[model samples]
Target: MSEALASLLTALADDELILGHRHSEWTGFAPHIEEDVAFSSIAQDEIGHAAALYSLLAQRSGGDADGLALGRDAAAYRHAVLCERPNRDWAYTLARHWVYDTADAIRLEALHDTADEDLRALVTKMSREERYHLIHADAWIERVAAGPVEGRMKLEDGLKEAFEEALGLFEPIEHEEKAVHEGYLPLPSSELARRFRELAANKLDELGVQTEIYSRSDEAAEFVASSSGDLIASGDEHAESQPERARGLGGRSGHHSDEFQDLWDVMTSTYRNNPGATW
Candidate 1:
């Protein structure tokens, strides 16, 4: 596998893993029985996707799939901050679902035509599952944003709080330009980011929610700061730097937030305790 392919796969796998955990955290806590069952299924699919991706990535990483997935410290995980963030409320979780599904849809679309045959096949398989995930997200976003006043307030607050960290989901991979040039990715990361912003903003607008979108000129420069690592967003990146961004960064660069460490420890504790044990 190309180095770029490996790096991209690692980041993608971590995103799924952490987001799966977050979704699963709501398994019993979802607002209603129907939602509880629905979200639990979604959580299962996400975790399965992560495991499958990790298995493929292990071939290039030269490690056991389980070990690769289980042994990583919080700082070593390449998930976006949005995924690792502790869930605050149902609206917040739903907002994250909206942001993540939008980005993941584009990411998978870009990878569908990858130069690597194996990756292309895996992405193709994942795409079918993600279609349903997108539907789920769309339904929830409409429900929350178009619901009661409290629901509207929560959705608005959630978007404002999460909008910046969600940008972290599109953090550039090393040699990302090379990948696009070489036909590994469908388009430039900037284009995908633009699509995400437009979709999110348009959705919010349809619901009568006011959202400030980034100007076309602010695209590349705002998303990736030179001083920060390719995967890390600088602390200075906020709504002022662009539009709807936040100050926190560091997930794509593998430097997770402080809250992530506890979540990581809990998630890995069972596997760590019995590395060789099997179900």
Candidate 2:
């Protein structure tokens, strides 16, 4: 019922929905049959995860899951820019998936100690599925990197292109501090971002890929590290200051692209005409 909890739920659910939609776009057009089947399954998994998160949010906020998912305006959705962006090429999807899923693994890990017992249990189950998601992403990443020059080049280009969007995955909203204070989340968004970068870098290194150096703002990094440390060490209300340097395309701030608006219209076409419509 708190702003922090709502933001977390909405953002997580939105990311899943958007990524699922993107993956679903490839259902009939994958590079091959096996990939098509695998991507379809992953798409289903992402949408199912979104449903689960939405259900938990509904329980906490006394809202209907269908309405929460199908009724939101484009500007109200809180997914990362990476998830909402078009799958420009297969390399882009692979890069985005690897980056997003790795960050997601870290994000979910930070929620293991959620104060809500039901949510904590849900996180446990969700983590199981997330592991496979990470595995799938990593496998493709490795395959492409270790394959032909064109494959490696494509993956590299995609990774560089999506780096900024990937950073958006951990952009903190105003109530993130409250979430940490209340034990709804164990780690602040800042720490999660650091862990994401580190983990992604490690994976790329293992695959023999040279990563582009991401520039960091000294002031922003200091504030995040300092504030994050204090919040973890002591439970208290902190300022609403967010990691602006990490913001990409303003997804977490409720701004979206035309691509997302189009996505929303298509996703909600049936429901818009009839709220009682069922899939």
Candidate 3:
């Protein structure tokens, strides 16, 4: 595979691997037995998908799938920051789930047209399983939206909290232009991001939630997270009072938050401890 294609595959696999771990965190702690089983199953599926992608990469790049999945340093991971964030609450978890899975669906749809037959086939298989995930997330979204006022409020709050980081899911990867030129990626991340915003806006409108979450100002590109975690536009006078935003920045370039380090240590400890061991 070309370096660009390898980078793209690594990014895709890393997203699934990290988010799979997050989903697994809920295995025994979900609100109900059904949810516990549901999340566990989803986690399994995600990890399996990651494994499949890594296997393809390994075949093309002459690397080990296990090494690709578990042996990478934290700074080498290309997943969106959204995938690495702690699941703060069920509402947030569901919100992130909806955002990530919906975006994944869009991504896979675009990948379905790729010139690479192996990747296209894999995407087709993954999309079949992903359809159920979408159904699960959409059902919960609708349930929370139609439930009590408190539930609706929490759901909305969670969506607002996750919205921007979700946008980072489409942050352009390194050499993405080459990937597009090679037909490895049929659509650029920006176009995919636009489609996601439109789809999300329609869904939120249908749910009676505010569509303002999808609105982005030109200054949004200038906004960066401060040391204190608040987002401030460069040279803006009221930087101190600006709300926290853009936690999803720089993930495509492998810059991650402190939370990722903590998660990474726990996640890689096993592999690091038994470097050559096989399961």
Each candidate structure's TM-score, on Cα atoms with residue i matched to residue i, is: 0.88, 0.87, 0.90
lDDT of each: 0.76, 0.77, 0.85
Compared with the true structure, the alpha-carbon lDDT of candidate 2 equals 0.77
The TM-score that candidate 2 achieves is 0.87
| C-alpha RMSD for every candidate | 3.8, 5.5, 4.3
lDDT of 3 by residue, 1-279 (tens): 688888889999999999999999999999999889988998899999999999999999887888988898999999989999999999999999999999999999999999899999999999988989999999999999999999999998889878867777887776778899999989988788778877888898999987666564223435444665333445666666754345586677787999999999998889989978988
The number of the candidate with the highest TM-score is 3
Indicate the residue-level lDDT of 40 in model 1: 93
Candidate 1 residue lDDT tens string, 1-279: 777777777888888988898999999889999999999998888888888888888877788777767887767788878898888988788878877888899889888888878889999999998999999989887877678888888887887667756667776766677777777776777777778777777777787776543332133324653643343233445534444333434566676777788898898899998867985
lDDT of 2 by residue, 1-279 (tens): 888888888988999999999989999999879989998988898898899899989998887777888887778898877788889889998888888888889988888888877778888988998899999998898888999999999988888777756767777754777988988878887788788777777777788776552432111232232343321111213333533333354677676778888888898888888866677
Better of 1 and 2 by lDDT: 2
Error of 3 at 123 (Å): 0.2
Q: List the residue pairs that clash in candidate 2.
A: none
Count: clashes, candidate 1:
1
Which pairs in model 3 have colliding backbones?
Answer: none
lDDT of 3 at 34: 85
